[model samples]
Structure formats: C-alpha cells, structure tokens
Target: MAITIALAGNPNSGKSTLFNSLTGSNQYVGNWPGVTVEQKTGKYKKDKEVHFTDLPGIYSLSPYTLEEVVSRDYLVNERPDVIIDVVDATNIERNLFLATQLLELGIPVVIALNMMDVVRKNNDFIDIKKLEKDLGCKIVEISALKNENIDKLIETAKSVAGQKKMTYQEFEEDVEKYIKEIEEFSVIKDNPAKRWLAVKLFEQDEKIMKEFPLYGKETRRLEEIIEEAEEKYDDDGEGIITDGRYNFVSNVTKDTVKKGRKGMTTSDKIDRIVTNRFLSIPIFVGVITLVYIIAINFVGGPVTDWVNDVFFTEIIGENFRGFLENAGTSEFLTSLLVDGIIAGVGAVLGFLPVIAVLFLFIAILEDIGYMSRIAFILDRVFRKFGLSGKSFIPILMGTGCSVPAIMGTRTIESDNDRRMTIMTASFMPCGAKLDVIAMFAAFLGGSWWYAPIWYFGGIMAVVVSGIILKKTKYFSGDPAPFVMELPEYHMPSARNIFKATWFRCKAFIVKAGTVILLATVAVFLLKSISLDGHFVDFNADPEDSILAGFGKIIAPIFAPLGFGDWMASVATILGLVAKEIVVGTYGVLAGIGEVGAEDSSMVALVASKFSVASAFAFVFFNQLTVPCFAATGAIKEEMGSNKWFGLAIGYQLLFSYTVAFMIYQFGRVIEGGSFNLMTGLAVVVLFIYGYLLFRKDRSKLENKNFSNKENDEVVKYESN
Candidate 1:
C-alpha cells in the first residue's frame, strides 16, 4: 500500500526546504480545487509510491485566513496517512503551537525539528525525548538545508502513518467541563474528532458550528456555559483556550528545554539598523536604486546590446536576408520573416538579459529574507492608506509579474482589502513593461535616471490610488492587522536563487516564443495589407496600410497626450495585448530592415515622432494602464465579479489617461508650445484631481461625530 505524508508548518520553518530535499525534482504544482492557494505534491525520490503533499504554511487550523482554511480542510477531509509537522528548533515554543492543534486531529504526526544546526550554534539545548513525550509524537532532529537526517525523518513519519495519537495537553477546568459535555452531547458521537469538534464549539467557531446540527437545548446550554466562562475569565472562549495552550506549552518547555546566554543575535543586530524607524525607508530606496542601476546600465545594458546588434541584427537578419536573396525567395516571404517575426520578437528577447539580472537580484533578496522585512517596514505607511502590510507583498510581486501578484492577494483576509489590492497591484510596472521603459529611456538620451523615474512613478501611482480608493464607500474600512513572522537572515542558497531566476527568465522566453510570436505575426499582417484591401510590398508607405486606418481612428483620442501619429496609437493599443508588444510594434512600424545595438534607427524614428515631453507622457500611460490581457484574466478571476472587474479596468484607464494627459499638455506649456483647448482640459483635470486628493473623507467625519456623541451619552448616563 502507498503511504501519503502531508507536510505542515509555520511560515519560514524550513518546511519548503525539507519538501525540496525529499521530493528532489519530482513535483507537481497547481492550485487547490476552487481556490487560488498553491498546492504542491511530490513523490519521494527513493519510492514513487510514497507521496507528499506540501500544505500552505500556516500558524493554526483556524479558519481566519484562506491558507488556514485550505490547510485545515485538507487535513480534516483528505486525511493524509501521516503529517510531518516541520518545526524550527530555534523557536520551539512558537513552532509547537501548531503541533498542539495537529495532535487533536486524530491523525498520526511526527515533528521534524528543522534547523538543528542553528539551534546548536546558539548553544541552546532541547530534550528531544521529553518534548516527544510532552507533545505525544515522534521527534527527529535535522538540518533541512544540509540534508541531514532527512532519511531518518521520513522513516519515522512513515512508521507513524495511519496510527491514532492523542494530545498530552488539556484545557483549564472551566473550558474542560464544557468540552466533555460537548463530547457526550451525542450529536457528534460517531465522529472520531468529537473532542476536537467539542473544543471548536467552545471557541464558537462559526464554520464548525454551521457544519453540524445541534438540538435547541444543547445550543442554549453551550451558549450559557460559554457566557459564564467568558464572564469569569474576562475574555472570550477563544482567548481562554489560546492562553491555556500557551500556558501548557510554556510549562512543557520550561521542564525540557535549556536556554543559552540571552543576547541580541546576528539577525537582531542587523534588524536594529535595517529596520530602524527613521533610516529604513531611505535605505530601501537606496537599495532599489542600486539594483536598477546595476541591472539596466552597468551589467544588462551591454549584454542586451550585443544580443540585439550582433546576434539578431548581424547574424540572423543579415545572413537570412542574404540567403533568401540568393535562393530567390519571394519578397512577401522575406518581409514577413525579417520585418514581422524577427524585428518584433527580437525586440522583446533583447531585454532577456535585463530581466534575468533583475529576477536574480529579486530572488536573492527574497531568499535572504530582506523582502519580508520590507513588508514589515512599510506596514505603518500602508495602514495609513487603508491597506495592510500584506498588500505590499503583492505589489512587490507585481514588480515581477502582475498575474501572480493579483492572485497573491488571496492571502489577504478582508474582501475589501483583497479587491483594492487587485485593483492597485497592476499599477506597479511588471517585467514585461521593462522593455517599453528601456526603449523610452533610450529615446531620452539613454540617461540612467530615466529608469528610476518610471520605477518610482509606478510606486507613487499606487500610493495615490490607494488613498483615493480607501476614501470611497467600497474600500473605506481600516486595514486588517498586519502580523507576519520575520525569518532569520541567512546566506542565500545559490541553487535556489538560480532556480528562481531561471524560471522567471524561462517564462519570459516562452511568452516571446508563443504569445509574442503570434501577436507580432498578426501585427505584421495588418500593417502589410493596404487600406484599399490588397496585400502590399514592404517598400509601400505605411499610411496606406489597414493598421494605419485603425490607428487613425484611435490617434485623435491620444492627441492630447502627444504622439498622436497612427503608428504610436496602434502601438499603444497593441500594448494592451502584451506590454512588450509596444516596443515590438514600434520596431515593426519603423520598418528597420535590421535592428542594431540600441536600435538607434528605431530610437531616432521614435524621437522624431515624439518630443521629450510627449515621450515621457507615452511611457507614463503605458506604465500605469491596465496590465496585459493575461493579467486582466487573473484580475477577473480574483474579483469574481464582472462589475468590480470592469470598475478596476475603467479606473486604471481613467487614471493613466489623466496622468499622461497632464504630463503632455503641461509639458508643452513648459517647452514654449501654445496653450490650447487640451491645455485648458489638462488644467481642469489637475484641479479635479487636486480636490479629490485633498478633500476630507466625509464618512470619517460623520463616524467621528457619531462616536463623540455616543461617548457623551455614556458620560451623561454615568453622571445620572
């Protein structure tokens, strides 16, 4: 018979590392059915029949968060043969909190004490035998990172499979009386988890209460018991149980564990500076600026130039064109191969070096645990805008890709916060948009500061949008409390960093080959066919092309933002398909026979069509607009309401248009251009925007007044 083991733990407990060690390269990743939370399953390298499910890292089985609910549901319903609860040895007290809950599940479990090396380095000692006895489970010490005792841990878990275990800890007398009463109530008598269910009932778990039917008398009795207990303890039943569990864990640890000399550790010492109240934001900004400088200018720029100029332009384009001529290949076919496919896809692929470098740095930051600290440091600022620090996580992920970033909002518990996050997350420029930003930066004389301007611009857009959205009725409540465990800082694993970087780069490469290839082909075809409805030669003027006709129709809409030419309008429209296509579209529209390093001809062409002011406006529009169609689909799925999805897309379009419009018209005035109707419109937009931004939220005022009135009434009643 095949044995199934489920891995569960708190976040940053090294559970993922342990899973990677046991499973090696044999793993399948997907979402759990009907939910966006990721579910990973893999078979043991040594025995394929023995499978493992890596549950989302969660602190408890409470249904407070989506992750907790998914983990709890799987453990309760799927009932895997064995659960290997990976525990961080350095933080045994907090790690065992989840272990205590798992014990009540009636499923066999083994505690894998991970990071034992770190524990021993600190000179702390844990009595494994006593801990095992106290928790009523098998315990194995292992360094998941070093691959030590992994085999033993798996063997121990397999041995405990399918066996029932009971928890050694018990609740206080008041809580225990009702738990026993609930067990004998007979409604859930056949349930093997009667004791666990009874405790959940005492805690008044709404989900659990709705699951089972209770007699009216049993309900009243339970309510009365809970109220009396709450009155006696001056707290809710949930808090009482929580305090009791911690008390039990404290007793168990005091008896069995010995602490080393207490002092600030290395991680603490670093956090003191990196997470300082005044210096954190400036430090974060400096780090980000340095990353972009290295990726865009210093390292990735040279590599990208070579790939574009030598590899594609010289070798591929030149050699292919020469061969086609010698073989007398048809003119139309040559144009399609060189101008359509090569120019378009090559434009995107040229940025592969930049994307790789960026992903590598981001992966390193994440692996070294600095990303979580960024979230922690930004929580205060985020809460002021009515978003939890958790929202910043998706925004950070958005810097890589918006699809996963929007989906990452599933971790947020509040519906309002999740939706708001989904709406604003895409405002951050994604990896795909990097090429567009780079192209515009090159157009603006290749200054290094161009990249940071757009990068920070996207961030400011998100912040401003958050403030505006939170004041509205749809997203007016206070943000949920921010609580996240900061993992210990350690040396980044090169293997993991390379793997993460490779996956991100691979995804970009795949899109270039698939989605981008098809889109570019379509663009070439549209631009090649004449408006009079006949195929045309490459030498023909682009104004006669069908694409020009369509672009002309949309060009007037963008005239206010400058770059009203049909080609620029068409490229902006195509960007909605994929942001990189904006650059590819320009390459195709410019009709450059061979693209070179920096594609000076294409950049020169764009520069002629757009002044500095207009170019920056164009960049702002593309950067702030709704992300690609794939990301839109993700937003739709996450929002789960077409109405809300439409609202999100509409808001993004309106905001991008206003920002771009202001940049162009105001910019023209500054550059000695005439003030006209568009300038007046821009002034009006600025005024309205200022009013919305500075206006006090009427809802907050009303709430404050109502609160003061209630306080006054209370004081008057007390005086009486």
Candidate 2:
C-alpha cells in the first residue's frame, strides 16, 4: 500500500532541503485549490508508491495566517497517514510548539531533527530516546543539506505510517478539566480528533468556532468555561493555552537538550558585527555596491562584450546576411531575418551575463541566511513610514522579477499592506530593467555606481510612496509587527545555488527567445512598411513608415520628460510588451540588429536623438513604470479584483511619469539650460509631492502598535 506522508515545519528549518532530497525531480508544483499559495507534492524517489506532500512552512496549526490555515485544514481534513516534521535542532524548544499541535491529529509523527550537524559542532547533545518518549513520536537526526541519514529518516517514517499516536503533554489540571468537559459533553462524540477539537473549542479558535458553532445553552456553557479559565489564569483563552504549551515544551527541552559551549555561538558573534545598529546600514550598502561592481562592470562586462560584438553582430548577422544575399533572397526577407530577429533578440540576450551573475550573489545571500537579517535591520526604517518590514522581502525579490515578488506578498496578513506592496514592487528595477540601466549608463558614460544607484533609488521610491499613502484613507495603518528567525550561518549548498540561478536565468532566456522575438518582427515590419503599404528601407528614411507616424502622434505626451523623439517613444511603447524589448526596439531602429550598452551605434543613437537629461529621464520612465505584460497579470491575480488592479496600474503610470518629468526639468536647469513653462510645472508637482509626503496619518484604525500576537520571548524561532 502507498503511504501518504506530509512534511511540515517552521520556515528556515531545512524542510525544503529535505523535501528536495527525498523527491528529487519527481515533484509537481501548483497552487492549493482556491488560493495562490504554492503547493508541492511528489512520490518518493526511492519508492514511487510512497507519496509525500510538502505542506506550507508554518509555526503552528493556528488559523491566524494563510499558511497556518492551509496546513491545519489539510492535516485535519485530508488526514495524511504519517508526518515528518522538520524541526531545527538548535531551537527545539520553539519548534516543539508545532510538534505539540501536530501530535493531536491522531496521525503517526516522525521528527526529523534537522541541522544536527550544527548541534554536534557546538558539542551539544540531545537525548532522542527521552524526547521521543515525551512527544510520542519517533526521532531521527539528519542534515538535510548534506543528505546525511535521509534514507533512515524515510524508512522510520514509513515504518510507523498507519499507526495512531496521541500527544502525551497535558495542560494544567484545571484547564484540562474544562477541556475534558467539552470533549465529553459538547464536542464531537466518538471522534478520534475529539480531544483536539475540544481544546480548540476551549481556546475559542475563531475558525473552529464558526465551523462547529453552538447555540442556546451550549453557547452560554462555552462562554462560562472560557471566562472561568481567563479569570483564574489572568489571561485570555489563547494566551492561557499558549503558556501551557510553552511550559510543556520548556520542561521537555530541559530534560532532553544538553548544553556545552554556552558563551555565544558563531552566528551570534557574526550578528553582533553585521547586525550592529551603527554599522549595519553602511555594511549592507557596501556589500550591495561591491556585488554590483563585480557583476556589472568587472566579470560580466567582458562576456557581455563578446556576446554583443563577436557572437551576434559579427557571426550571426554577417553569416546570415551573406547566405541570404547569395541565395537571391528579397531585401524585405533578408532585412527581416537578419536585422529583425537576430538583431533584436541578440540585443536583449547579451545582458544575460550581467543578470546571471547578480542572481548568483542573491542566491548565495539567501542560502546562507543573511537575507532574514536584512528584514530585521530595515524594519526600524520601514515602520516609521507605515510600511511593514515584510515589505522588504517583496521589494528585494522584485529586484530579480516582479511576478514572484507580487506573489510573495501573500505572506502579509493585512489586505491593505499586501495591496500597497503589489502596487509599488514594480518600482524596483528587475532583471529586464537592468538592461535599460546598463544601456543608459554606457550612453551617458556613467560611473561604476550607476546600476547600484537605481536599486537604492527604487527603495527610496517605495519609502516615499508609503509615506504619501499613509496620510490617505486607503493605506493608513501602522506597520505590521516584524518577526523573523535568523538561521545559523553555514556554507551555502552548491546544488541549491545552482538550481536557483538556472531557474531564474532560464526564464529570462525563454522570454527573449519567444516574446521579444515575435514583438521585434512586428516592430520591424511596421517600421519598414509605409502608411501607403509599400515596402521601404526603415534604416534609410525612417519617418515615412507607419510606426514613425504612430510614434509622432503620441510623442508629445512624454515631451515634458524630454525624450520627445519618435524612436524613444516607440521604444517606450514596446517596453510594455517586455522591458527588455525597449533595448531590442532601439537595436532594430539603429539598423545595427544587435545592441549593447557598450556598442558605439547604440551610444550614437542616444547622443544624436537625446540630451543627457532626456536620456536619464528615458531610463527612469522604463525603470519604474507599470511592469511588463506577465507582471501585470500577476498584479491582477494578487489583487483579485479588477477595480484594484486598475487602480494599481493607474497609480504606477502616474508615479513613473511624474518622477521622470521632475528629474528631466530639474536636471536641465542644473545643466545651465533655459527655464520654460515646464520648469514652473515641475516646481508645482514637487510641492504637491512634498505636501503628501509630510502629511499626518489619517488612519481610521487605532494608533496603537499591533504586532504579532505571539510572545516573542517564547516563540522566538518561528519565522514566516
């Protein structure tokens, strides 16, 4: 018989590593029904008959967050035969809070003591036999990242699959008396989960109460039991039960966990320096700046040059054109094949080196667990602006791509914060926008700090937007409480890093091959054919074509931003299809067929058609505008309402345009140019922006800081 086992854990507990080791390439990923949160399931690599479900990482079975609800529902409703709960061995006291709840489901449970290597490294020891006996579960010590004893862990889980076990830990005697009364008299009779359900009732869990609501005399009795417990314990029902669970876990840990070196672990020492209040921000800035320098200007520069110069312009364009001419191909066909497809797609693909290198550094930071500290450090800054520290996760993720970043907002518990995050995340320059930044930097002979400046600029935009919106009725709430666990520093797993890089790079390559290729063909055809439908050389005349006429029609809308040239307008319009297509469009227009930031033809195109201020404005417009087609779809799905999606898109467009306008007019004045009507308008816009930014909070909700409900001292290891 096939054994169904659910793998569950707290975030950063090595659950994901263990799942990948067990399932390998046999897994399938999708959303849980009716929700956008990802669900992963697979059959065991060693034995296909043994099925495994990787449940969402959550701290407890409480229905407070979507992840917790999804996990709790699946365990209670689906009733998986057995569970492998991955617990961080170094913080077992906190992780056991989840273990206590999982034990009540009447399913066999196996505790996978992850990161045991770290425990051993510290000269600490755990009494597994005693721990197992107390928790009523089997225990296995394994390092998931190293694939140590993984087979043994699976074997033990399967061996106990169908057997039933109940949690042995009990609350205080008086609390247990009321819980038993509910189980025996009011809650489900003859149910295996009756003990768990009765406890849920006693605690007055909102979701559970709604699911199995009582009426008449039952309601009064339920209220009596809860009020009596609250009066006796001097706490709410949830708090009382929470304290009971913590007491139990504390006792168990004292008996099973043995201390060795107690001064401070290596991670604690590193955090003292890296997370120091005075030095943290500067250190982060230095780390990020150094990372981009190595990726963009040093290592990635040479390879990008080769891809743009020798590979695309010399080899593909030259060879293809020569072959087409020899075969007596028509000019239209030759131009379409060489200049249209090869030129445009190659221009975008040349930046793959820069993108892949940057993603590698990000992957390393995430795998080594430093990314969590970033949230903690930035929380103090973000909270004052009415934005949650959780906002940084999506904003940082947006530096890679906005699609996944928007989806990541699901972790935020508040609707207003999630909506605000989805709207502003596009301000971050994504992998595609990096091409725009690189192109413009080379166009203007910008310094090594150019690319990094755009990243920090994006963060500033999010902060400024948060401040403005906090004074409005729609987005005025105190920042959500930020709580995260800092995992111990360790060597990054090579396999994990490689997988992250490959997946992200593959998406970029695929889009260039498909979306940009087709869009470039259309752009070339429209520019090559005249309004009268006659074939003309777009490189020779350019103004007589349909695309030119269309660009001229809409060019005035961006005239204030200074890039009023037809080709610049054409490039910005095509950017809506995909941000990288803007580069491809410029390449196709220049008739160079392959463009890079360092290419003389692209630099000449900008110098002839744009001033320095106009070029900066053009780059800023593309950097912060409404994202490409795919990301807009993600925004729509995340918002889950057409009204909100429209509002988000409208807001993004207005924000991008106003910022670009201000930059150009102010820059023109800075460059000793004549002031005009547009300059006066820019000043007015600046005044309005400053007023909104400095306005007082107008939130309808109470001003009190509402953090996570759990006591941080007790559940210190739980992370989103």
Best by TM-score: 1
Off by over 4 Å in 2: 165-167, 215-232, 593-599, 700-720
**TM match of model 2 to true structure:** 0.93
TM-score to true structure, per model? 0.94, 0.93
Residue 548 C-alpha lDDT in model 1: 94
lDDT for model 1: 0.86
Estimate, for each residue in 277-387, the C-alpha lDDT of model 2 and write its tens digit.
898899889888887877777755578767776688888888888999999998789989988888888778878889999889989998998888888888866786667
Cα lDDT of all candidates, in order?
0.86, 0.86
Query: Between which residue pairs do clashes occur in model 2?
Result: 343-593
Model 1 root-mean-square deviation: 2.5
lDDT tens per residue, model 1, 278-300: 98998888888878877777654
RMSD of each: 2.5, 5.8
